[model samples]
Structure formats: structure tokens, C-alpha cells
Target: MNVKTEVKQIGLYINGKYVPSSSHRTFEVKNPATQGVIALVSEATEEDVNQACLAAREAFENGPWRTMSVAERCEKLRRMAEIILERKEEIAGLDAIDVGKPYHSTVQHEVPRAAHNIHFFADFVQMQGGETYPMEENFVNYTRYEPVGVAALITPWNVPFMLTTWKLGPCLAAGNTAVIKPAEMTPLSVSLLGEIAKEAGIPDGVVNVVHGLGSVVGTALTEHPAVDLVSFTGSTATGKRIMKNGADTLKKVSFELGGKAANIIFEDADLDKAIPGSIHAAFMNSGQVCLAGSRILVQRSIFAEFLERFTKAAMELKVGDPQNIDTKMGPLVSEQHYQKVTSYLEIAKEEKAKLICGGKRPELPEYLQKGYYLEPTVYVQENPKSRICQEEIFGPVVTLIPFDTEEEAIQIANDTEYGLNGVVWTENLQRAHRMSHSVRAGTIWVNCWFVRDLRAPFGGFKKSGVGREGGHHSLEFFTEAKNICIALK
Candidate 1:
């Protein structure tokens, strides 16, 4: 497929206007697939971030959004979802180019999921209600949830559009205005939200976006006094920093952080499903996903067979231009990230792990040669405590460790500091139940990977994150509950 390499200028969307940064500075956003400058985005300074927070604060304090009826608010959310679906192709294209995600996956999966998030939350909020208590005949008590006010939403580069909507949906549904700082590496697709919000009849200053490096822009937003809540999705290290930054003001903070999830395959597992599912679990989005099951634990009985099939499948993944429909994997998001991921190859060698399939960059066409592409890598390690097994490489890398029994599998899986996500592949119902309960993670998948329901609580247990945000959990985080009692005559 022929892809356009048009260069556009993206500005900070503050209040209701698309304006340049206060410093009049801009940064280049390059396409990871072509190494070409796709856009020049505004570099938000502290002043720019403050303006966005002030805009959100002003809108939340005085605008009609907070006072709008639940039905009316939902209508606007539905309209935003509609616009997202209508421009799905355009938005998907931007993300594919900006984040180096496969266009097929973005257009067919992530974009639609982004729209679904808005729709689901809009519908969910309408059915949501508070508790009513009747104490005796003399008095009655009831609770109500109110918008918290200005929210600072910090999103990551991988799956930027979908994750932004994931946070934005509940924030807006609860009637809170927001200032968003999309990952500077992949800011193009999220830059469309400002226009989407306006066209959907959302009031000005209700949803503002500022783009810049996280150190400057993210810290400013988190530390802003006017901001009521901070919802962030990124590295665990950054999540910790945001916590400290917001500590002075005691801002309500929710984070969905990093993971090194364990995908365990029991001997009773169905390899037909496990092989492909495990491949997707490990290498989806070039393994840039926070939920990527980078550790695969196979029962020793089927270890050799699983290794053969898994390595073969990993080698067959198509790595090239993200615009190509057949391309299953694309380049890492940036040169810096490419370097970070490739460093793990050296780490694997230093750890004395067996190199199973891939650990080098693939030979691409002349145009894509300059892109940040790497082959999907797999390794077999005897020691589960190796650095390659413990740390999050955040790339297309997986470490396979052999285990003897379910007890050992559980032990190895829980050994990591991260408890974000895990996968259990087995047909035995009893074992599945046992493993599900034994694994120390937020969400455990049984014979499935990446399948989600909007109603379930989504967050990590340990170092993965601080709080949960999905369904009622999301509403709980975005709103403040108050109780009012009345005395009967």
C-alpha cells in the first residue's frame, strides 16, 4: 500500500484554540516505520501546561458540563464516539505512522476499541447509581457522586488513541474537565481529540491537550494546583514520580503502569491455541504493550515441543512497513526505544540465556532500512531469576523458562515485582481455577489473551499500579461521593 508522508504542524490545544507553545518551540515527530518527519508538534512548556490546567479548571468550575444532565452528557459522549468511528481510518493511519503500530491492527482493532470505550462508559454511567439507606421511619439517607473537577490525563505512546479514550471517557462521563499530555513520541493521533470534542458539541476548555516531553509537561500537569485528579498510564518509575509530584496537593491519582506478565502453559494445555495465543501475548505491538506476557513458562513435559512451535511462529511474523496489511509487526516507536529494546539482547547474552530464534534487525527494503525495526526475539533461559526475566524490556522479546509443576510455575510467575496481567493456558477446569487464584496479578486470562470486558475492574496489584479504573471503579475514581440525610416528619 502506498502511504502518504505529508508533514503537518501540530499545536497545543489549550482552552478552545489550537495555539503555539509559550516558548514558540516545536519538536519533530518521526514515523518509526520510515524514519521520516511526519509532523512538527508544539513543545509545551510549564506555562503552556499551566494554561491548559487553568482552562480545564475554569470550565469545570463554571461551565455547563458539570451541571449538565446525565442524559445530555451521555449524548455528547455518544457523538464523540460517532466521530471517532467516522474518522477511524484517518486516526488509525496517524497512529500507524506515528507509533509504528500495524495499520491493520490500529484500524481494525484499536480505533474501534477507542470508540467502544467512549460508548461503553457513556452507557455505563447512566445506569450507575448511589446507595440509599432508610434508617427507621424517621430518617432517610442517600448518596450522590459529583465530578471531582479538573483532571490531568497522562497517556503513553503505545496504543495512544485507545488509552487516551480509556481515561477520557470516564473523566468526561463523570463531568470532569481535563488537560491531557499525550506521549511526546506518538502525539499525532491524540491531537485530533480537541477537534473531536468541539464538533461533538462539547464546550470549549472542557478537554484540552498539550504535547511535550514528559519531564516538563507531565510534571507540570501533575503538580498543578488547580488539577483535581491525575490519571496516568506509563512506566512504573514515572508513575512513582507523579505520585510524589501530586503529594504536596494531595491530588487523587490513578495509574496503570508497567508489566512483565507471565504466560504459563500447563501440560494439559491445548498447544493449537496456546502456540498462537502465546505468540500474540508476547510480541503484540512489537511487544511495546504494558500488558505483554513477556515471560512464558511451559511445563517441562511439553517444553521442547512448545519451544519448537513458538520459535517457528515467532520467526514467521511479518516485520516491515506498518502500512502493509500483511505486516504483523512494525518498528519500535522511536530510535531511543529501539536502542532500549535492543540492549536486552546483550543482557540476554550476558545472562547466559540460550538464544532461540531472533535477536537482530531484519533486512528491509531501502526505504524502510532506516526505520527502527527489529526481529521478534525469543530465548530459553534456565534461571528464572535472571535480569532478562525480571526487568521489562518493553520490546519484541520473550524469555521462556521451563517449570516442572504448577507450584513451581506459580512461584516463578509471582517472583516479579509486577502484578499487572497473567495468562493461564490449560483445559483442566480445576487447574485453571487453581492457577487463576494462585497467580499474583490484576487480571488473569484463561486460554485467552487481550480479551476484555468494559465492566471489569482493570488495574495492577503490586508495583504494577496504585488504583483500579474500569466500570464502577472508574466512576469511583473520577467522582467524589457525598451523603445527605433527611428527617421524616
Candidate 2:
């Protein structure tokens, strides 16, 4: 595949216009699959982030967006969904090239999911209603939900576009204005949302996107007094920093952070389904997912057989050009991330864990030789407390551990500090139910992986995250509730 070295210019979108940064500073965004410059994006200064926050604040407080009828608001959101689908291919391609995700996966799954997120939230806000309480004859009290003012949405590089929409949908649906700071590495697709919002007839300043580094832009946004609340998705350490930044202003903070999820297969499990499902759980998006099951636990009865089949399946995955439809995996999002992931191979060896299948870059065409490509890696570690088993590698890596009993499996799964997501595979109905409840993570999957319902509350426990989003949980986080009382004459 021929890689494009042409650099497209991208700018900050504030107050309904695309403009260069106040300082006119720019940064290069590289294609991880080719190590070539894909775009030169405007780097937001603290002043630029302040401008975006002020614009969002003004919009939420004085614009017609909040005063618009519910029907009109929903219609505009629905239109945003429509435009997202209409331009799905273009958007998907940008993400594929910028984030090094497979084009097919981005188009087929992430793009549609982004559209669905907007559509679902648009409809959900309409059906949502306040609660009423009847006092003793003389008076009645009722609760009304009002939108929180300005929101600062800080999204991660992995699955950038989809996650941005995931936050944008609820924030806008509830009448809040936004200042989004997408991850600097994959800003291409998300920068297009400013135009999408404008074309959908959303009012000016209601949606603002600033492209820049986290230290400057992200810090300013989180600490900005004009920003009412922050919804962030990224590393746990960053989440804590945002919390501290918001402390002075007492900003409401919701975070979806790191994870080292566990996927357990019991002796009674069907290997046919478990093997492939486990593969998808661990290696999806090259294992950059927050919910990636990096820890795989198999019962002693089937450990050897499961490892053999799983290793072969993982080894067969095609890792190359993101543009290729048959490519199952792509490079890490950037050279820095590639280095971070590869460092774990050394950590695994130092921990005395045995490498079961892969840990090296694969042989590819000369065109892709410079790409940050690594084979799907599997390891066997007897110590559940090993760094390879406990920490998140955030790459195409999985550590296999064998357990003799269901009780031991649960113990091994719950040993991690992360409680984001987990999986249990078993034929015994009783055992499945027991394991699901025993796992400490949020959103445990029984005989499945990544099946999500928009209505369910989605967030992590422990170090994974702080609050929940999705369905009414999103509404709760994005809005403030007030009780109104009336006296009867």
C-alpha cells in the first residue's frame, strides 16, 4: 500500500469558525502505520483553551440553544447523526490514518457506533422525565432536570471519534455547551465535528474543539472557572490530576480511565466460542481498549488446549496497512505509544514470565517496514501478582494463567487494581452467574465480549474510573436536579 506523506492543515474550531491558534503554533500528526506526517494541526495555547471555554460559557448562558424547544433540539441532534452517517466513510478514513486503526473496523463498527450514540441520546432526552412527590394535600413537590453549564470533554487517542461523540451526544442532548480537547495524536476526525455541528444547525459557540497537548490545553480547560463540569476518558493518573485541577472551582468530574480486565474460561466452557471471543476481547483495536481483557485465566482442565488454539489464532491475525480490508490490526497510535508498549516485553521477561507466542515486530513489505507494527503477543505467568498480569500494557498483549477451581479463578481476576471490565466463559449456568457476580469489575460479560446496551450504566469501579455514563446515568451526570414546590390555595 502506498502511504500518503502529504500533510493536511487542521485548525482550532471555536465560536463556529476554523481559525489558526492565537500564537500560530502548529504540530505534526503522524501516521503510525507509515511513520509519515499525515497532518499539521494547530496547537492550542492556554489562551485558545480559554477562548473555547468562554465561547461555550456564553453559548450555554445566553444562546438560543438552551431556549430552543425540546423537539427542535432533538431534531438538530438527529440531524447531526444523519450527517455523521452520510460522511461516515470520510470520517472513518481520517481515524484509520490518524489513529492507525484498521479502516474496515473503523468504518464498519466505530463509525456506526458513533452515529448510534448521538441518535440514542437524542431520543433518550425526550423520554426522560422528572419525578413528582405528592405532599399532604396542601402542597406538591416535583423535580426538574436542568443542564449543567459548560462542559470540558477531554477524549483519548484510542477510538477518538467514537468516544468524542459518546460524550458530545449526552452533553448536547441535555442542552449543555461543550469545549472538546481531543487527544493531540488523533485530532483529524474529531476536528471535523465542528463542521458537522454547524451543518446540523447547532448554534455558534455551542460546540467548540481545540487541538493541542494535554499539559497546556487540557490543564487550562479543567481548571477554567467558566467550565461547569468535565467528562474525561484517558489514563488514571491524568484523571486524578483533572480532579485536583477541578478542586478549586469544585467542578463536577466524570472519568473513564485505565483497565486491566480479566477474561476467564472455566473447564465446562465451549472452547470453540471461548477461543475466538477471548481473542477479540484481548486484541480488539490492537488491545488499546480500556476494557481489553489483558488477563486470560483458564481452568487447569483446558489450559493447555486453550493456550494452543488461542496462540495459533492470534498468530494468524494480519498486521499491516490500515487501508487493507483484510488487515485485522494496525500499528500503535504513535511512535511514543509503540515504545511504551514494546517496553512491556522487557518487563515480562524480567518478571520471569514465559512468552507463549509473539512479542516482536512481524516481517512486512518494505513500504511498511518503518511502521510501528508488533505481532499479537501471549505470555504465561504463574504469579497473578506479576507486573505482566496486573498492569495494563495497552497493546496487543495478553498473559495467560491457569486456575484449578472457580474460587481460584475469581481470586486471580479480582487481584488487579483495575475494575473496569471482565469476562466469564462457562457452560454451567450456576457457575456463570456466580462468577459474574464475584468479579469486582463493572460490566462483567458472561460468554460474551463487548456487547453493550445504551441503557445500561457504563463505568468502572476501583481505579478504572469515577462515575458512570450511558442512559439515565449520562443524564444525571450532565444535568442538575432541582425540586419545585407549590402551595395549594
What overall lDDT, based on C-alpha atoms, would model 2 receive against the true structure?
0.93
lDDT of 2 by residue, 1-489 (tens): 333557999999999999999999999998888888899999999999999999998998999998898789999999999999999988998998998989888888999999999999999999988888888878989998889999999999999999999999999999999999999999999999999999999999999999988889999999999999999999999999999999999999899999999899888899999999999998988999999988999888888999999999999999889999899999888788889999999999899999988899999899788889999999999999998898889999999999999899989999888999999999999988898889998899999999999999999999999999999999999999999999985
User: lDDT per model, in order?
Assistant: 0.94, 0.93
- Candidate 1 lDDT by residue in tens digits, 258-367: 99999999999999999999999998999999999899999999999999999999999999989888999999988999999999899889999999888998989999
The CA lDDT at 146 in model 2 is 89
Ten-residue region with minimum lDDT total, candidate 1: 1-10
Pairs with steric clashes in candidate 1: none
Q: How many residue pairs clash in each candidate?
A: 0, 0
